[model samples]
Each structure stands twice: as structure tokens, then as C-alpha cells.
Target: MKSAPRSAVLHRMVMPGHTCPYGLKARHLLRSRGYEVEDHHLATREETDRFKAEHGVATTPQTFIDGVRIGGYDDLRRFFGLRVADPSATTYRPVIALFAMTALMAMAAGYAADGTVLSIRAGEWFVAFSMCALALLKLQNVEKFATMFLNYDLLAARWVPYARIYPFAEGLAGVLMVAGALHWVSVPVALFIGTIGAASVFKAVYLDRRELKCACVGGDSNVPLGFVSLTENLMMIAMAIWMLLAYGM
Candidate 1:
């Protein structure tokens, strides 16, 4: 006879005004993974708290397989040979999302400006928008960004203030480019930072072979230091050169 399918017991919070989305996700995961789930919904806050206290577990949406606790969603993923939960784990997802959104926004702006998406204007908008997005990420926590930047940036390591001011400079350049004004300010700023950033990334990642997290997305980002970081600097350099050639600055 064939063996019965494995069954799981899932205890999840479904209290009034507090439906745990993870609980639904866990249930979906269980069903998708070929597990018969016995979902135990805690319908009230008091009941949820009592369950947690009784079980000595910190959070809800807990799962059990074969009478052995498999933990929450992250734990369930691990139990099934999926990704493990580590808060500081490095990932490129955030940077990818930011860049993707920037591109889309630039495309939209291009269409709005002249009803054309395949023009040189679109490319300029893309680079300008990308700079703004990156600057915003760094500005979220300047202190944290500065700390991470110091790990690789030559000027930041020597002069701490440069790290603090980097985001503002990048943002200003981006805004000026977007407006098609103030080439005197934006051109120099973009060229200066771009040159320094490219050199720093190259020396640290290519020459020294140092493995480190990029501070481009944010100070607490998991984005690795390499191609993406180098690309951002290169884009700025290219944009600066393009602008100079166009306006003779």
C-alpha cells in the first residue's frame, strides 16, 4: 500500500482586526508542498497570547510536522530546503527593485515630455532618475551610509565629511539634470564623484579582491560591492561627458 501524505499542524493568529498575512502564506505553502494542514486559528488576541505562552514561542504562524515544531514561515521554508532566515544576509533584491522602478519612472517621464519612449531624452531621464533614487537610498541614514562608505571610498576614509555630503551632492546633480539647468554645478559634481567612486570600487573589489556590502542602496543594504556599484559610477561619468559635449561645458 502507498504511504499516506504527510500532514502538518499550523497554529496561526486570526484575531479580530489582526489577521496575520503570514498565516495565509504558510497555509498556501503547506498545501503547495503536498502537506495536509490542520490549521488552528487563534480567533482572539487573548487566545493567541495564551497559545504563545503555553507553547513558549515568541510569534505565531507556527508549523509542526510529525509532532515536531517546524517554526514560522521562514522556518517552514528551511524545513523544506528553502532559504534560511538571516536578517543580515546579502541580497541584490533591493537594488534591483530600485533600479527597476527608476527605469519605469524614467520611461513614463519620457513619454510625458514628448510622447516618445525610444528617444535620447528617455536615456537621459533614466540616468537622472537613477541618480535620484540612489541618492534617496543613501540619504535615508547618512551616518550608516558614511560608515559603510568608509570601508571602500578613499576620500571618505580620509575625510569623513565627504561621506556625509555625498548623497546631497548626487541628489543635487540629479535634480539639475532633470531640469536641464545648472550644468556648471551638476557637471563638475557628477564627474568628480563618478571618477572617485569608479576608482575606489575598482581598487577595492578588483585589485584588493575585498568582499563587502555596497552602500549604494542604503547603509544597511546587503547589495554586494562589484558590478552594480561600478555601473552606477560609470553611468554618472557617462552622463557628465554627454552633458558637457551637448552644452560645451
Candidate 2:
């Protein structure tokens, strides 16, 4: 008779009030991957600490396959050839989620104000929300965003400080637009940055034919440096124009 496959040991945190989320994830992953899991639940904080110390590991959700340590959840992912280990892999998911959230907010705002899911006010709100969201993303890691922006932003390439100031400018514009105050400041700023951005994106992605990541969503983004970048600039331009036309001058 053939012997059954050996089980993998999964030692994870399970305390009185809280259980580690990654531990649950690791357990599920192991079971879903057809490994019989020998789940070892750390019942208390002291037990969890002791387990970590005894295993010479720093985190919970440690896995052991055939007596060889597989580290934590990320390590288990690596062992199974999953995509969790890579930090620099390009993907559009972040930008997609951001834009999706923006759309949802815009729709809700529109409906709340006008009893419809789409309207001019909603459009305005959407642009303002997008500016804030994108600014926040950049502000999360300004250094990273600046490094990426320098790759294609003509102004940032020429003046290093421009990269650092860009997020603040975007955030200020977003706040002013949202408040419906200081149009003079917001409009000019939006037009200035949007026009420069449009030209730079066009030159770098179209004229130069260079494939690069967009810093529109942030420095760590995997968003492609083409349509999405262009769209961002164009939206800003359109919003500026709309605000000007709506309020005059």
C-alpha cells in the first residue's frame, strides 16, 4: 500500500482577544494547496512569544515542511511559487482600485446632492477627490515618488525640489477646489501643473517612445506611463476649465 503524503506543520498566533490574520491565511493556503496541515495554535501571548523564540523566528504563521522551516506567510508563498515575495513587480491594481473608489464616491456625492448618480457637481467632486487621493499616495513615500517622477517629469528632472513640492501642490489644489474657495489660486495651479504634465507625458511616452512607470498614482505604482498619465493631466485641465467657465475668470 502507498503511504499518505506527510503533513506540513503550521504554528500560528491565537490569543485571547486576537488571532493573527496572516496565521489564518497561511493555514488556508496550506490546506488549499493539498497539504495536510498540522495546525499548532499558540494559545496565549506568552506561548506565541516562546514559539517565536524557540523557532528563532520573528513573526507568526511559521510553516514547517518535512522538518524544514518555511518561515512565515510570505515564505510559504515563496515556497509555493506565489507572487507575494516580489516588491517591484509592475501591476495596475493600485491605480484601478483608487480610480474605482473615486468613481464610487463621485456617484454617491452626485446622488446625494441632485438625486442622480451623475451630474456636473459630481464631476467636480470626482476631480477634487482624485487629486486628494493621488496626492495622498505620493505623500505616503515622497522620496520614492520623487525618484520615479524624475524619470519623466521635465520639471522634476531639471529642478530636484520640484519633485518634493509636487505632492503638496496637488494636495493644496485638491483642498481648495473641494472647498470652493480661492479659485484664483486653484485654477492657475491646476492649469500650470496639468499643462506641464500633459506636455511631459506626451514627450516622454509618445515622442521619446520610452516605456516607464507612471508617478501619477505614486512612486511605487505599476501604472503604465501612457493613457493613464495623459488622462490625469487632461482631467485636471478639463476641471480647471470647467471651474473657470462656471464661475467666470
Candidate 3:
């Protein structure tokens, strides 16, 4: 004889204009775990509020198993002995992904253009691609990036607008380098920012021994201020010097 299937009750908000993502996740989790979910939809704001009040809970997507409250999505994960993510934890995922993607892109570009991925041009593309990608991340929210950058950047501390201009300059330099055009413009821009950035990062993370979030990927990133950030700045500096020497600019 087979055992009876486990059952769960899920109360989630499914308004006309919006649906709660956590609620969807909860339902999926329950179903995936062999629980038959009696899904209830709170279709309006008033209905959702009333449900929360009646249950004495602050949030929706509440789950119940065997007549016991399982709370929200994170709570449900806890019930199943799953690891919950801590929002405050420092992570290197963003930087890792950014570097991995840019590296792949560089190889692809090299293979397509020069018929080889192990050439000097490929290495140049890697650095240029990384610069553009990092600049793009910073450009997403300049105000936020500037705020984070001011915490450690010497130039930004002195001149507020430098923070805002940094991303654009980096991007322009990267684009020019990739095109192999306007070495006069790209070399100087990359060298100037790279020098300042490396000095600032070294001072903050090495000399001061401060544990802070890096603004390399973006203002919202949780990547620690350390070797990866230093490497990024150093790569730009090296690329700028190489361009200057190679083109005699």
C-alpha cells in the first residue's frame, strides 16, 4: 500500500496588476516536494491585507503543513533544511561572472577576427572587454556608484564629479582600444583612471586594512574590496601602456 501524499495550504497574492514572486516560488517548492498544495489567491490589496491581519502575519505567500504555519519562502526553505541566503554576506559572484563572460567574449572576438584565440589581439580584447563590461555595470546607476566610490576613491573624495565621469571615460577608452583607433584618446584616459583607481584601492584595502564592498561591478554589488578589484585596475593600466608602446602614441 502506498502512503498518502503530503498536503499543504498556500495563501498567495495574485492581483490583477501584479503577482507575488515568492508565492509562485512557494507553490513550486511544495509541488516539487510531493506536497499537494491547496493554493488560495488573495486577488486584491484589501483581501491580502485582511488575510495577513487574520493570520497575524506581516507578509503573504504563507505556507501551512499539517495545520502548522510554515511562514514565507525563506521559512519554508528552513523547514525543509535548506540553506537560506544571508543578504549581508559578501560575495564574489558578480565579479566572477563578469570576468568569465568577458573572457569568453574576447576569445570569440579573437577567433572570429584573427582566426586564433591564443594571439596577442585576444589578450588585448580580454582587457578591453573587461573595461567595457565594468563600465557598463557602473553606468547602470551612476548616483549609487558615485556614492559607493566616494567611500574609497581619492579623486572622488576631492572632486564629486569625478565619480560621475569615471564610467564614461573608462567606457570610451575601452571602445577606442577595441577599435584600434584614436590611441591618443584611449591611452591617456585608461592610464589616468587606472593609476588613480589602483592607488585608491591599494590604500583602502591594503594600507588601511578596511573591509569594504567594491564598486568595481557596481554600487549594489557585494564583492569585497581586494585582489580582484586590484587586478581590474592593473589590467587597465597595463593595456594603456601597451597601447602607447605598440602604437607609439
Model 1 per-residue lDDT tens digits across residues 75-115: 89888898765788888888789889988888898889899
Measured against the true structure, the TM-scores of the candidates, in listed sequence, are 0.83, 0.77, 0.95
TM-score of 3: 0.95
Return the lDDT, model 3, position 234. Answer: 96
By lDDT, the best candidate is 3
- Each model's total of backbone clashes: 0, 0, 0
What's the distance in Å from true for residue 145, model 2? 1.4
Give per-residue CA lDDT, model 3, range 17-123, as digits (tens).
99999999999999999999999999999999999999999998999999999899999999999999988899988888888998899999999998887789989
Cα lDDT listed for each candidate? 0.92, 0.89, 0.93
Q: Give the CA lDDT, 0 to 100, for residue 146 in model 3.
A: 89
Candidate ranking under TM-score, highest first, comes to 3, 1, 2
Tens digit of per-residue lDDT, candidate 2, span 156-180: 8899999999889988998899888
Estimate the TM-score for candidate 1. Answer: 0.83
Over 4 Å off in model 1, which ranges?
Answer: 1-8, 14-21, 28-50, 56-58, 65-68, 78-86
